[model samples]
Target: MNLAGLIFVLVTHFLAGRGVMAMFGIKENKRKTLALSMIIGVVLFHFLPVVLEVCHIAITATSISIAIGILTLALFLPVSYKLDYSVLKITRPSFTLYEALFATLLILMVIPSVWLCYYFPVFARDVLSGPEPLAEYAVREHTLINSALSVDLTSTNNHLKPPFILGLQVIYKLLVHPFGELWLSIMVCSFLLMFYTLIRERVHALIVLFIMMLFIMMPEIYGYMYIVLSDYPNMVLFFLAFYYLGKYLETKQANTFYFATFLFCLASSIRSETVVLIGLIVPLLLFSFIKDRIKPGVIALRLGILLVIPYLLYYVWMNVFVANYMHIQFNTGEQLSVTSDSVNIFFDRIGIILGPMLFSEHARELFGYIFNIFLFTLALDLVLWRKKIGLQARVMLYGIVVVLVGLPLLGAIIPWFDINNTTKRGVFKLFPLAAFYMANSPTLLQLSQAIKRFEFPELTAQKNAAPVMAQQQKIKKKK
Candidate 1:
């Protein structure tokens, strides 16, 4: 392992990401800021490899270092004029007993995954056919358009996909490990931290712990943490886009909204189909604008940013980048269907998903009661104990519908989006949305408040007394 190079990547990525946050004037609490900085840094660095390829620069260590130096300087130098030197100090926050236990458990769970990821060889067939080999030869040949493109492997069309995974792989293989998958670990850890920050403020620590455990234990989703696939990272970016968008609605922070749209663009670049998903979100965005009394021109411009950026990114990859590199012709139009049979196919796939895939024993093994729990809680909310669902929860529910319906809709339109393969992996996107809903559920919130009261009786008493005390003050004034 290239220890020095690995450290270089980690340090520079964090600083660069911090620089980005500062430049945009987007500040969160320190913990969240750190986590977001790391994620943003890693993703921004991945683009460096792609830029090198586009410029026909050699993908060597020297070239990578130079590009990174430039990028880091570009992002960091402007912000250097007013550096918060406090960022250098690492003060430890006091964790409650519940928080400590959960943090330790999460770390233990993640340690092995990281070790296994680094120790094992790349074995996923889809990866081998596309990103892995493409990355491997890119490292060996010092170019993205390498000898691998000359070979004919008719079994997979992954080669025709975007360079999101392949670019990161090339950078990691050049700078970190020969396997080039440690980048995924960084993404996973950073995302877990960001995810923790998301609901921690809304619920008690115990409830936060429970939700985090539930998310991490989803067998299929957990496996993707170590496995190098675009789906997992795609899921992270997609969820965060909506997450930050929700925050923007609540806070009306313009910078936060811009960041959310930027994340949506990044998600689309990871998977072209994500563009369709972003389009599905437009109605919700329009509803939000109309409700907010936003002007027609502002709504149109914001909508344009949401729709146009992702589409341009998709177009660039499929038309400009791939066309420039490969001779293969792609007929995406042929992939679409608009017949009665298409509607029938969509319903049939939905049935299979709702039936055998969701309720079967094998489904239990893959998802492990997570979805069942979500459905039960949602049913309770709808029927027996409906609490007023908040806007955040409603947005999450919308996201769940988008993924569940969107995947089959894609399958119906494109025959190759099979249930057993493409759609199955795509379901990974639903886990985060479901978990978010569970976090915001009235039952869970009530339980969380109970836990808080139990854990801090004095604090609860003070909270209870505050209203009565205010009432007493008003009575005295009237008398």
Candidate 2:
């Protein structure tokens, strides 16, 4: 690889890995976000290598390495103050169906977008095809595919397999190796499974499910559905981890906690940055466990077990084994510029990513149509949930999860850049989780309730009402 090519590849991985590390500090599970971030870094670095030639700037090995280092540092600065495990204290747990519906619908909406983006070849077609043999692309991954499967994983990659990408490969192999038409089928199932779990009530299931199936309303999901990328599955992992965690929070049962923890661990392995999601969740969990000002010693012990232990293992394995022994660089000089607008570059691409009829330009029109059909049905869901769930609706719980998870995700996506990096990577993986949350949005309730007034059956009030005690007492006195 030439100097420019090397620079791009290295910096990309570095940026992505570091980004995941930081995200882990918050969510404790952002491996996919981390892996995809590196991809973004490489894409941005290699975009215009010749632009350097025209500028008379010579790319050097020293500059490339330093750039990666600085960018990594930049990613961690946000967490510098909040690095302590104290934040792991758990908090009050609640539920609301709206949140679940929101996340489910958002996932359905965005995966289709990601697929269209790839299949149509708008963003980066050279993806698996490998870049036109360049010299200075940064980082060096994709070596595993060459070594293990003996397939050219470097076609879309210059060197290494970012964890998210690796997880995608693993998931694909487990489900169906040599991906074909069935790719989308698997994608649909993974997403559907997580959302379906949120449907505890049969009354709202069909209504929420139908809204989620409206994939065309959201552009990002439409683009993701058909591609052989990590975004779809990564989002699936995110939702599953959180949904299970929400269950654990509500019940605090050992089985629920164990399953939730396992899913979170699995998610971290799937995408490094997902570690952030897991980490952030632990502290939020701690908030719940720490109330009543539990004995300091006890709190510390719980915090250690709940938040610190698993993460330390993940960190040690990733740095000591993956990045070091793997001998792969994921960043470069241009890609690293700390003072530059990496986040901006990420958001700028959103338009192209989402703007394509039943696509981006007419999102307003598409949304109006979708809401109209589902309006009454959604209303029925809320009424049913009120009767069934009473004060403990999963929707309220979902809103809390969104608030915790969506902030950083929001920070990552608001800015745009053409540079391939973490912000966009996280953005891409975020949509499915968002859809899953939306599946339980109040919008679903409104529609479902209306349906009850029309097609669905409604229970009648008791005809033989009992007299109030006060009224009975007055009648006896008169007699």
Candidate 3:
């Protein structure tokens, strides 16, 4: 039954994704289209229950299932009529022996992580205090329950946090009944698959697979995979937004732009802190249009509608509905004031927080080694190929720097919690992007090219020698 529910949910997302891709006329790249579709589908699925709740409709399992079914059919029908079935087929790519071995190694590494999601208990403290109670209340009550008003569970002051993941849990509970843990596994696996699909375009298949291993093996990343936390979901959404933005820059495709904007908004909705991505993304979009000598007004209008409007709506909704219900106030007086001591502490902890070293003893044991490896790779890439880095990569690097620097400043100003831990996890939100850019760095690309030259020197020589030999023969004939 658990397996059935998983399959059902996965298929529904795929179909809905394909429909979204078709609607946007995104047909150039198959893998990207499929990946973006799945992501958009998940976002829409999350929003469906919210819309129902807002309309004063009951959110029972049966109603949710029927709504999803109707949406799937509505989307699939037109897509089927318009798109050729062959476009959806997944053809296998031929691989060299080295590639095959690396691919196998990648798969082996991921299997343990996926298995851990199933075998390990859902034990993240934040999950128990945060999303779990919300999911339970929503599923049990057949409506969105006011956490502050509910007596059954303690509210964690996260009522304004987006409900996308909670809505997913509700659907999973309805479908699978009691097997809640399986849903966590499924969500984690889905993220891995999407990561692979997005990365394969920029890096070699072997390198892409290796990066996946690195991501899942990271203690911080895999720890949250099975836990009902918002961090992993926010990571996925941030990566998706940037992935599409990179695509838009490279291909100058409007559909990719639309997708990027949508994902950005969704990411901000998932985590308020992710609103910072707007500052990182808008400049890139403007640069793309200006570089292409395209009018910026059109880009500005589209962004205003797609990115700004959605963010504003979510902000207002959070303030009016969720915040009011939870008795939370959003005011300037609540801001944390900066002091000399706070500044000193922020500077002192900056190394542990933004650096690769894990500060917590338990987290250090689990994630220390993997985090150091990432740090080494990042340092190596920047030192060796700083000049060869592409503009898109440079933008991402700048964004990372801004995040690392800006977050500490925020922590200094607002001494709300342990600045060390806050900076550690907060900066972690940029890990996927950091790893991705590092993997596709010019140094890595040059290394891969050199490896190809060494492995197939004969092929390389034949191509180069052909032109020289032709010239020599021509001289001999002339003589």
Which of the numbered candidates is closest to the native, going by highest lDDT?
Answer: 1
Say which prediction, candidate 1 or candidate 2, comes out ahead on lDDT: 1
**TM match of model 2 to true structure:** 0.49
Give all TM-scores, in the order shown.
Answer: 0.95, 0.49, 0.82
lDDT of 1 by residue, 1-479 (tens): 99999999988888898898788677777778778888888877877877888898989999998999899988998997876777668787888888889889999999987987799867787888988888899899998778888888677788888888888888888888988888888889999998998889888888888888888998988898888788898998889888888778888877888889988888888888998888899888888889989999999898999899999987777777777766566767876877889889888878888888777999888878888999988988788556577778888889988887788788888877888877888888888888888888888888888988898899999999999999999999999
lDDT of 2 by residue, 204-229 (tens): 55565554555344444554456545
Q: Number of clashing residue pairs in every model?
A: 0, 159, 0
- What is the full ranking by TM-score, best candidate first? 1, 3, 2
Each model's Cα RMSD: 1.9, 15.7, 4.0
lDDT of 3 at 395: 55
lDDT of candidate model 2 versus the reference: 0.44
Expressed as tens digits, the lDDT of each residue in 1-479 for candidate 3 is 46676677778888887887777676746655555566666666777677667667788877888888888888877877888678657788767675577667757765775666556545656655655666677777777654524553433444445766666667777776442455455445566666666566666666665666666677776666655666667777777677667767777888888877777777777666566446655665676677788776886786686567556856765776566544556552365686668777667656656444454566565454544555676677779866777866765666566566556666666655454355556666667777777666786677667766877899989989999999999999999
Return the top candidate by TM-score: 1
Regarding TM-score, does 1 or 3 come out ahead? 1
lDDT of 1 at 430: 85
Candidate 1 stretches with Cα past 4 Å from truth are 82-88, 384-387, 473-479
Model 1 lowest lDDT segment of ten: 322-331
Please give the lDDT score at residue 474 for candidate 2. Answer: 88
lDDT of 1: 0.85
